[model samples]
Target: MDQDRGYNNYYSSRNSRQYEESSNWRRGNVNWDSQWPTDRYSNSDYYGYTRSDTPFNNYNQSSARYEEDYSRNSYELDPRTMEFDRLVELLHPKFMSEYLNKILTFLKSNNTEICFPHIAPYKEAFLVRIASDHKNLECPAFDETCQNISRSIRDFLYKNSKLFVWSHSYESGKITKNTADTASSPNVILKSSSSDAIDKDSKHKQSRLKKKQIELVSTDFKIQAMKTILDFIKDDSRSLLQYPDLSEVQANFLYTLLSCYDKPEDGAEKSLLLTPLVEALKIYSLKYQFRINKDTNDEDCRFITLEKTLKGKSSENNFNDSLKSPSPSIMDYQDLDDWNTDVENSDATDHRSDGVPDFGGKLNKNQRKLRYLFDQVTTDFKMTVLQKSLDYIEDNSRSSVQFLNLTIHESRFLKCLNSFPLSKKSYFLIEKQCVPLIMKLRRVLEP
Candidate 1:
């Protein structure tokens, strides 16, 4: 009986071990999410295929299995998901406060007095965080808002790195009481006199005149307004740094002031902003030979007499210079047709040190020749251009009382021109022909 019991026990133990191995193997092979058995691998099941023996059924089943496996684990370790999780973690109130404190510290350290004008405090904090941590951080690729925020941070950082200072003209600081009183002195007053015989007509006319006078603001007020804006820049230019285009702010300040004036004086029709705005643009456009309009309809032209009048003694020299010659024309330049033909026929070639073809060699050669042509142009033409610009400032009508040149109120013309990319010859030419005129105008216009 003992021997029989031992044999039964051994048999039972062996059966139990076999069952464990089989269960382990099944667990390894099967996916448990769907109903089990994979329809028992039967090709003729209700989800039916007529071919019971074909490998095609097995292939289809394997493909379905692969697709199910892919769907199950596809997003398990996705980079986008990871980044999204990180973003959420960092955006928590405590984590966000750390970033804001860092930004506030950076600003304090740098003496940067103002934040971007339009950005809200919270968004500014986010931008600071992104800029500070850009290289070490990642935004979720799937989250468009986060991506945009990231992009904006990069752009702001780049612009800040390459910031240009719009120089403030508030050198004199606040306008003084004495200066204000002097500025307030009326330069021009319009008066109308009519006989008492036509008393009703005179009353109506006087009423109309008073209304017109009300529309006309004093030029002094406009000058004072300009001074106010300059003071703002001097005090808090950090606030203006956020703008991509500096010109827009200048235009805005001028336009805002201009709108307040019903009908400005003839010469001061445009706010003082126009001159400086054009001056700033002149640097970028000098190669294109930018010049302010000198026609009478243009407000700038009206100011030229003021500029010239300020010139005083030099006005005699300018009169003599104007009498020296007529204006130069485009015809004065040499024909480049021959040069183009020569370039086309020439077989000359140059190569870079690295054996790459130098495509720009021909361009450089052409430009050199063009510069030579400019150099060879007659002094008369240069003189003519300068004279015409000066004369167009005015017809020299009130010769007894020197009229103001455009430079009278502002001596920034030469300063702005200095910023331009002038060739040596062009510089000398302008110096010889126009510098004296500019100097004269500036001297006269000096406050």
Candidate 2:
């Protein structure tokens, strides 16, 4: 019996030891709040996925671990694309190092504005801060390092913006560190006279490749801007008065893009698409406000009214306002003036920001015929809206349905077609000669 009791005590002691170890083991494993976690646990009681974009997940991650080239020029010392978490960590004003001030200075000098806020969609405010009141946009030039920085910020913008529609091609492809190291194998080259040529060629190729990729990404952003403008155009409740917050040069770029819109044939689609687009062209004309230099009716000779106002006076004021009036520097003003003369310093400005109408010198047939109508609208905008209802009264081509709708619509055109006793051809006596001329101006001449 005593032997049996001894065996029981030994077994009890062994069981106690095992129970203590098992408790410790369970405690360690319970902290896997993430399906995957290198540091074991998240703060949450329930473990799910340790999402990389958790506002502060890995906010303290070191940049050198991701990109060997984490410097001002914005070059990746290595080919490894920066991971998203690292970007957030680097750009976040609160969490970032002193280098953020350098970024702020560079952006400020270029008149770039970045906002940091609490409520942002997808936490974009922390990742990328871009937008500027200045008309000129200067991305990093062929300098791969500069563009590489632009590319990263732009990527953050590009990815977050995809919640809307069509969206770019050196998408810093995220991969394992081991994989990047393997993929970017060091070149086994001889230490010889030809080494210089080889390095130059390699650099040139890399720069070209990066440029193409970044430009493609920029194109995607521009496309989103175009779509936003289209939505603005269709909503008649909105107007150029509440025009999109774009610089005058940006407005011009959109104007050039507008002319290139592939208008569809007349149908429900035409009424839905082309008609509003036509109105947009008229409203958009406000941005392109300029007069032909009578001497050189050469369309190229057109001068922008915005030069003295937009780039000269207003830009200085805006800069002062942005910089909080810290003694405006002459050198900075000189640089700005240089920028004014050439609004776009990058290679992409081919006629887009040169302040020239995309339409050639010769006015289109409708533009020639309807000069008086549109010119009046340009000169006296408020009065010419009646041009629509007035034209409808005189238009023989107006469908019975169109005529009926206008009469009953309780619009500015209400009871405009026929107020009997006044001729059915009302408001027509003065411009009787225009019975044909008005019809001749039919190509987008209507309101």
Candidate 3:
């Protein structure tokens, strides 16, 4: 058993090293033949399948070409240094916030779950329990809701949240006031390394997080986040509400997600959260400033500073009379203050590492690469792929087969992920939310 594990690790290192060496080729520094592995089983030692097993028939060739072109043709990019705002100018603030407000309204009002086309036997129970736990919001892990309200909140806010501080612009997109002290990495993925008797205890704990979603968000945490924003507004909005670009509910969702980051190195990692958080804050022209004349006990100010001249608007609108104070009155809670009282008694940082965790476990090499693939892609793309894997897992889990080997279609999907153009960014963004399905996939493959 030990020999097999070591063997897997050895090949894993070799393949990754080869991939890294090719990284220089990718940079166009050398005239290199893109020596993609042709062997079927050579790279499958850790990941469990080889290239020949998964064909490119199912993958998007056009996207592959576009990414390749995008990667290679630096000269094609607009010669003038395009600002992040210029890159995403289409995302209008009024539309962004208003659309999100509607979604938030729907989420809070949603009473039942939408029946999915298919769900794995093992995952059904987990998804049901999760749906029950989260009264309104849709789970991107089970169904394709990534492009819906959830996607808008996570991607938009993840892009904007860090714009709050300006680290000199939240350290030019390095960190955020809300999640300044978040874990640099998530808890290691815990797995049974041996078929020995001691495995029983770990398996029990493992089962608890078996169906944890990629975006480890829960409603309780959002409530707490909403409470924090309201507290800041109540104490010192600094006439931030008077700013046309900023909205109460928009800020609530922004704080809720940017702060839900965890690393144990998984999807929806801290970088994802911070980037979007900063972007949104910058777009809204808002940030958190420290109260110098504190009572000395306060540790930090809430991330809620706002720039009055973000749009160069001098209109002194009634900050209080504009948008209503964001509240849960649509559902059960009477007002923001009511939820605030509840939050004070509960954990404020609900999705922080200490809460009901989806990660803080263990991971193998292929699994880490799989997670990195997720981070490199766009949020909607990552969420779509995660939804795909989840669908495959659900269908596969229902089969009462003697042994579950990778199907041809599954192989192709895996190949696409491994071969997908890798992208990297220097800082964190709003979120790369879905690690739930991949972790589940990891369990299935590894187990």
- Global lDDT of each candidate: 0.33, 0.30, 0.32
- TM-score versus the correct structure, for each prediction: 0.20, 0.15, 0.14
Per-residue lDDT tens digits of candidate 2, residues 354-402?
2222333444332232222222222222234235434543564431112
Tell me which of candidates 1 and 3 scores higher on lDDT.
Answer: 1
Q: What TM-score does structure 3 among the candidates reach?
A: 0.14
Off by over 4 Å in 1: 1-253, 256-376, 380-447
Residue 388 of model 3: what lDDT? Answer: 57
lDDT of predicted model 1: 0.33
Which of the two, 1 or 3, has more TM-score?
1
**Native-to-model Cα distance after best TM-score fit, residue 195 in candidate 1, in Å:** 64
RMSD of each predicted structure = 26.6, 27.5, 33.6
lDDT of 1 by residue, 1-447 (tens): 232222222122434443322332324433433523445555543222234523344756644554554333323222223243443443444534444354334322433222333433233334433433455335453245444444554554446543311111111111111111111221111111222233355346544543344346455544554464344334422211111121322333333333323333222234354445333333323322211211122222221111111212333222211221222211122334445554455443332232222344343554443433333334454455445545644554422121133231121222222221222222322334455554543333233
Total backbone collisions, model 1: 11
